[model samples]
Target: MKNIRNFSIIAHIDHGKSTLADRIIQECGAVSERELTKQMMDTMDIEKERGITIKAQSVRLDYVKDGEHYILNLIDTPGHVDFSYEVSKSLASSDGALLIVDAAQGVEAQTIANVYLAMDNNLELIPVINKIDLPAADPIKVAEEIETSIGIDATDAVLVSAKTGVGIRELIDAIVERIPAPSGDPKATTKAIIYDSWFDPYLGALALVRVFDGEIKKNQLVKLMSNNEEHQVLDLMYPHPLKRQKTNAIKSGEIGIVVLGLKDVSIVNVGDTITDAKNPTAEPALKYEPAKPFVFAGLYPIDTDKFEELRDALNKLKLNDSSLSYEPETSIALGFGFRVGFLGMLHMEVIKERLEREFDLDLIATAPSVVYHVYLTNGDMVEVQNPSELPSVSQIEKIEEPYVKATVITPSEYLGNVITLLISKRGMQDKMTYLNEDRVMLEYSLPMNEIVVDFYDKLKSISKGYASFDYEPIDFKEGNLVKLDVKVAGEVVDALSIIVPITSAESRGRALVKNMKEIIPRQLFEVAVQASIGSRVIARETVKSMGKNVTAKCYGGDITRKRKLLEKQKEGKKRMKSIGKVNLPQEAFMSVLKMD
Candidate 1:
């Protein structure tokens, strides 16, 4: 146990954390050179294509230091703010962490946020400067910035280029010398925390755990502390990149995978505690708290008959991604669908894409919205996730929307543009600090609704892809808000409804109706598209009817005969317009997002 080190790699997106992880695994000789791959820790196809880590992965490594064998358990964590929950769980299972900073770009918003999470877990941190081979690399300046901004002693910060494999040997030595080994009683009752869980087709549900006390052996009956359910451990194995190695027992202070031979992954929930059923421990290793979703959106199959297939796909996907939550809902415009909850916009995008690719289903996602707290005149409050669910304006007293503390770090040149963007999104400045001569960190309190749309994309574009942003939910605050509903040819489409602040409701309604006019197909009769707030219409657009030659056959007839034919055609159009149904294309549903 003294030679064992349990740690995780933490950094901002595109800061060489994944590259550093690849280098470390190579140095430890975990995989052969012929089979080694880039971003080995990121297993998903979407992750590889996008160059991002969506899920946290772990691997065990063996190293020889000074002629002594050492065991290292390394957890590679996601850097995006959406997957911070994954980082928190990974940090909880680690005794130390390696903080990687880009030599060209010093501390970032996510870097500071993750540092706080590591600090809360009381994990030892090792600062490492990466990308030192780049022409713009400045390790000394970054070290000083880390010291001032993060308040960490970076005098001994390791300088290494993860891309070129420099300083890897010395970094491994530092991990062995600095990071403390796991400490727990091997003779005590079995106690371990399930840091991660996933479903396997052949093996059923598997849990990656860190044993704190005693040992978990094959065929042992273990009880889950969260639900008091017991299951027999069918197998035990240590984690690796290419393949997992079989093991008979997982001793204390070690990380390994436990197989329960169950079909459901929910039974082996993440953050849950596992202990011996007969010799139960007095307390759990860690308290379990499931992730809370902040964004809600409706996902509907393009083919309404495939609703059941969508449900089945969701269930299977949930086995792999436990953060996803959904419930059955029906929309008048889109028919039967599910109202899904997501951690953020990126998470919602990834899940939607996965369902379409993995299950071979066509899906349409509604505009994402945040949870709203609506207070009634009778002193009662109701939570609203969908715009259609909001009570009538006459019955409601006030509405409050969720807000978050947004942190942005950008170059000095983009400070004005970043501030302007934030202000346009209804963000209130909180504080600003100068991290260095050329970088500034700005903090603001922004509504969660604004961030869920296209805030990240706009930020990246405005900053020229040189800024990093992170946010945490703060609280709900009262706002002058109203529910905006869309009417197509006199019928309300529930799926097109959205909530907007009263101050900007008029402009938003105008923009929405104008965008919808271009998407709604022209029918034989004129279609009136209207946007309204309760009973008042704020904006309206007309899709002119397709012209037809009603009097073309009457060549030399009297003028009165032509007039009679036109009159008859007008009457028929009036009747058709009353009973006509508009078929809204997928683009019409997505038009809500394009509303500027």
Candidate 2:
């Protein structure tokens, strides 16, 4: 245990966390130089393409220091704010963290957030300034900023270039010397924390756990503390960047993977405690709160016949991602589908992409919305997850929308633009401080709905990609909110509904109809695309029918004959308008996502 070091790498997105992991793995001889891949810790293809870590991964490394062998368990974590819960879980399972900061970029919003999380977990911190190979590298200034903003001693911070493999050996040495070894009793009852899990077609659900007390061996009957369900450990294995190595048992202060051989993946939950079923411990390893989603969206298959396939895919995905939650729902425009909840917009995007790519199903996702609390005049409160389910304006007295406390770090040059953008989103300034002479940290409280849309993208655009943003749920606050419904040819399209503030309902409705007009194809008859708050339509656009000259067939006919033909054609159009159903393309539903 004294020679074992368990730690995680935490940083903002694109700060070389994954790259640093690759360098360390190479330096420790975990894998040969020829076998090493860029960002080895990021195993998912999507992660590599996006240059970000979406899932947490762990690896066991054997490092020889001064002729003494050491066991190093390094966990790689996602850097996006959407995956903060995953970061917390990784931190909980580690004894220390390597705080990676981009030397040129200095500290970011997510960096501060992750630092606080690591501090809360009581993990030893090793600050490492990465990207020193860049021409604009400023390690000295960055170290000073970290000390001033995070209040951590940066004099001992490790300076390294992850891309160039510089100072990697020094960083590894720091990990072995600074990070404390895991402390637990091998003789005590079994107690392990399941930080991550995944589904295997033949082996069933595999749980990635950190053993805190006692030892977990093959064929041991272990109970999940979350539900007190017992499952015999079919096998044990140590995680590797390239592959997993089989192990007979994993002792205290060690991290390993346990195979339960249970076909039902739902039974294996992350953040659950594992203990000996026969000799149960007095308490679980630790208390961990389940992840809560902040954004809600509907995922419907383009072909309704594939709904079941999508469900199965989601279930299989859920086995690995416990944060994903969904329920069956029916849409008038979209047909049968599931209303899925996600941690954030990026989370939603990742899930949608996975479902489409992994399951090979074409899916349409509705506009993301935040859960609203509706307090009706009847003294009853209801939670509205879907905008279409919102009560009528007459049925409700007050409506409350979830708000978030957002933290933004930006250069002083873009301070004006950042503030203006926040104010436009109905943000209330909470506090502001200067992190340095040119960098400012601004705090604001804004509606989650505003942030759920394209707020992050807008922030980056306004700041010219020089700013970083992070947010946390604050609380539900009363707002003059109303459900905005989009109607196609006098019928409401439930899938295109959204909740918006009354002040912007008219303008947003106008935009929705305008975008819909551009996307909805022309029918045989004129179609009225209307946006309504209730029975009253606030905005409308017309999709005119393709012109037809019925009178041309009777070029020289009498006036009475032409009039009769015209009346007949008019009557036919009226009937067609009544029965004509508009077949909107997938792009029409997506248009709502772009509504300002």
Candidate 3:
């Protein structure tokens, strides 16, 4: 175990985490040159196209240092705040981490957040300055910034260009010399932590685990600590870039994949402990806590009959993304659907897109909302995920919405714009500091609801994409909030209902109705798109009826005859308006996101 080094690569979004991972894999000769591609660890097409990492991946490497063979287990993690839970879980499985910082960008909000996470895990950190090949690169300045802001010694920080493969050899040598190897007893009872699990059609569910105590061998019956269930290990393999390398046993201080040949992925939960069923360990290998979802949205199939298919898809997807939670729900506007909980907006988007692309399903996702705490007059409290699920006004006492502590790092020139944007989102200043004369870091407390929709986009736009943001949920606080119900032709569209702060209810209602008017297709009769609170309509917009000239045939008739035909047409429209069902295009449901 002395020659074994396990480490995770972490960084802010677009700070070369994945590229650095690719470079390291190349340097260690994990994959052949003919098979290697960019972002080798990122297997998803969406991740490739978007230039982002949505999932965490691990690979075992063999390296020869000074004529000694060394085993290096490297885990590549996502840099986006939405996938930070993946980073945390990956960190928990590692003994050290490589903190990658952009040479020109210096430190970012997510960098600080990830540093804190590493500190909490007590992992040895090696600061690495990437993008040194760029013309504007400032490795020395970034190293200083890391030491000042992150309070880590950066004098020996590695300077590498992940794109051009500079300093990669030195970085690997630093890892071998500095990061501590895994320490556990190979003779102890079998104990392992399942860091990740996903479904495989041919192999059933596969768990990628780190062995902490004993060894996991083929045909060994193991018990899951999360549940007292026993399953024999059908196969064991070391994770690799192109194909898994078969192994007979996974000894202590090693990471490998265990196949139990079970169809149900839930049984192999991430963070669960696997121990020898006959001589099980006394306790779990690590203390595990499930991920908590912060945002909620409704996902409905366009074809109601495919509801069961959607459920099946969700179950399969849950195996890949365990953070996702869903429950059955029905809406007047939309038929049977599932109310899904997500970690953040990006996560919601990725899941929806993946469902559409991979499962071949047409889905409509309602406006994302945060969980709200509704207290009743009788002193009963209920948690509300869907706005339409809110109790009647008469039964409610007060409403509390979740809040988050947001950290933003931006250049000084955009400080005014950033502050204005935050304040407009009902943010309260918490603290502020200057990372240097030109860059500033601002902290704010903002309602979770405000940031769930388009805050990140706005922040990026106002700052010209020079700022980085990250947030963590703090607690729920009471707020003067109201539910805004949207009505189409006198019928409430429960799917479009949203909870908003009482202060901006009027403007939000107006903007929503206005946006809806543009997206709602014109019907044979006029449709009144109204935003209301209870019985009071706050804003209304009319989607004008499609004109049909009934008097065209009587062009030469008397004026009274033409007038009579027009009157009949008006009466027909009035009758149709009462019963005509509006076919809300998918864009109408998504219009809620564009209501600025």
How far in Å is the alpha carbon of 390 misplaced in model 1?
0.9
Q: Which runs of model 1 end up more than 4 angstroms from their true locations?
A: 550-565
Q: All candidates' TM-scores?
A: 0.97, 0.98, 0.98
* Candidate 3 segments exceeding 4 Å error: 555-561
Cα displacement (Å) at residue 350, model 3: 0.5
Instruction: Give a tens-digit lDDT track for model 1, residues 1-596.
Output: 88889999999988988889999999999999998999999998999999999988999999999999999999999999999988999999999999999999899999999999999999999999999999999999999999999999999999999999999999999999999999999999999999988778899888999999999999999999988999999999999979999999999999999999987656777888999999999998997567889999999999999999999889878767778899999998888999999999999999999999989999999989989999999999999999999999889999999999999999999999999999999999999999988999999999999999899999999999998999999999999999999999999999999999999999999999999999999999999999999999989999999999998899896899999999999999999999988899989988998888
Q: What is the lDDT of candidate 1?
A: 0.94
Candidate 3's error at 98, in angstroms?
Answer: 0.3
lDDT score, candidate 1, position 73:
98
RMSD after CA superposition, every candidate: 1.5, 1.4, 1.1
lDDT of 2 by residue, 91-119 (tens): 99999999999999999999999999999
- Which number leads on TM-score? 3
In candidate 3, which residue pairs clash? none
